[model samples]
Target: MTAAIRLATARVGDLAAVMRVMDAAFEPAYGEAWSGAQLLTLFALPSARVCLAWDGEQVCGFSAARIAGPESELLLLAVDPRFRGRGIGALLMKDWQAWAAGEGADDYFLEMRADNDAVHLYEQSGFSECGRRPAYYRGNDGMVRDAITMRRSRDRDGED
Candidate 1:
């Protein structure tokens, strides 16, 4: 049976998968910088919401966000390498955006390495580069990389 992609509220049981994808996606860039405990805290935070794309028991993609004080932040998003370019990332993002808007967020923010290829996807989804942080990420070899901060607005009253 083929697993369908859908949206659901994240639960404590999802922590293992969340850690897996986050480390898989950021390992090259963050070099084990984030521990599972840290990820658990983020996932368990009241302001943060998570959505996962699953293929049966396996998680193919995931997106996480934090919404509070009229602002939201996309903390993580990733598609399994085998599932990239299949619109799964977009689906996860859309789910997060909808949830953010419903929670009273007027805008969303995300930060990624300037060189990350996924930056284009975020841009295509209407995110705009708002600023940059120098030496924001610690690479595998101990080198620091620049990060670009992006933002997207959902309009007053949450239109579009």
Candidate 2:
């Protein structure tokens, strides 16, 4: 029988596999991929956590985030190209918010390039743009892209 796909909390031991997922998910021409060292350092931080969706030994997707005080920020979310449009990214987003909410986070935020196709997914997940950074991201082709900051409110009073 084949092992079923499942989501799990990522650990240091999973770094290599996680990086493979990241590399496969991102388009290298965009220069948005994070190196293994960067991911290792981020995961090693006290406030950061990663959630991985795995199919047996293969990493299908992952979401990394940081929680500080009453707020939490999604640092990165990626799913292998072969897994796109299969609801993997949405599951990761929901998991990130749910995990942070359980930890007393009242506001969840994420920053992404304005042209990202995932913006619709984020909006569908209850996020709204709260800020913007002009020309914040530069691609390998020398073009700059705007960055948008989105927030999801977990409190009834709309306060973070």
Candidate 3:
């Protein structure tokens, strides 16, 4: 039987696990994986938060985000390739949103390469395309990709 997955708030010590997941989930050609130092910087920020998903003692996924004033942006979200299709991404999305809400964020945003398959995942989580930046990312393969920005608002009652 496989181990049950669980989510937890990530601490500085979980950096290694986060890196492991990021390395396994992100393609090197995309050049999207962040370094341990970068993650540590985020961890130091009072406005940022990180959540990790664990399968037994192993970290299977992680989501990082930050809240600024009334806005929250998802900095990164990754699930180990071996653990995809098991709803880990969706779970992390939910945790990110919940953390943002608790932080009093009225809007949530995320940006990713235009061709990223996670677009569907964000859409299913209530995020919609809001903007785009042409040639925003130059991958390791020497190819440039557009960046797609997505947003989700907490004012769902039409009472803004």
Candidate 4:
């Protein structure tokens, strides 16, 4: 039997699950250096929108966004290590896009470390590189790193 895939809203109680997925998907080299407390702050942000993918009791993947004015910025996306290759990331992204569209967002954006392989994922989701911030990220290597900014806009006909 195939495992059921479910999407649900994330709650204050789900911070630990979200952190678990993030820590597993992003090692010290990739994550934002955010402690658990910092992540909790994200849960508290007024503009925050978070969603999680579940396979029964396990959290398979998650995504978050923060909307400001006309732009919705994807803040985090991670799939559990055990469930990485089954299109869970894409599922989470689709959910996020739906939420942003419901919020009347006209544009969506995200920033990733220049070396992050997930840039390809964003591209596959229709985001295009619009700008870059050099030396924008502080790496574990004790050097600054660049970040690539990507964007996707809603068509005037209201399509992504």
TM-scores for all candidates: the values are 0.88, 0.91, 0.94, 0.91
Quick one: ranking by lDDT, best first? Answer: 3, 2, 4, 1
- lDDT, each prediction: 0.79, 0.87, 0.92, 0.83
Model 4 alpha-carbon drift over 4 Å, by segment? 1-3, 31-33
Task: Tell me how many residue pairs clash in candidate 1.
Answer: 0
Give the lDDT of residue 72 in candidate 2: 96
User: Which lDDT tens digits does candidate 4 get at residues 6-117?
Assistant: 9998988998888788888887854473567877777788778779899989987888887887789998888877887788888878788878888878899998998888
By TM-score, the best candidate is 3
How far in Å is the alpha carbon of 113 misplaced in model 1? Answer: 0.8
113-143, model 3: which lDDT tens digit per residue? Answer: 9999999999999999999999999999999
Task: Please count the clashing residue pairs in each candidate, in the order shown.
Answer: 0, 0, 0, 0
Question: Residue 58 of candidate 1: its Cα lDDT?
Answer: 81
Query: Distance from true position, residue 41, model 1, in Å?
Result: 0.9
Runs with alpha carbons beyond 4 Å of true place in candidate 1: 1-3
Worst 10 residues of 3 by lDDT: 151-160
Q: What is the model-wide C-alpha lDDT for candidate 4?
A: 0.83
Q: Could you tell me which 10 consecutive residues in candidate 2 have the lowest summed lDDT?
A: 1-10
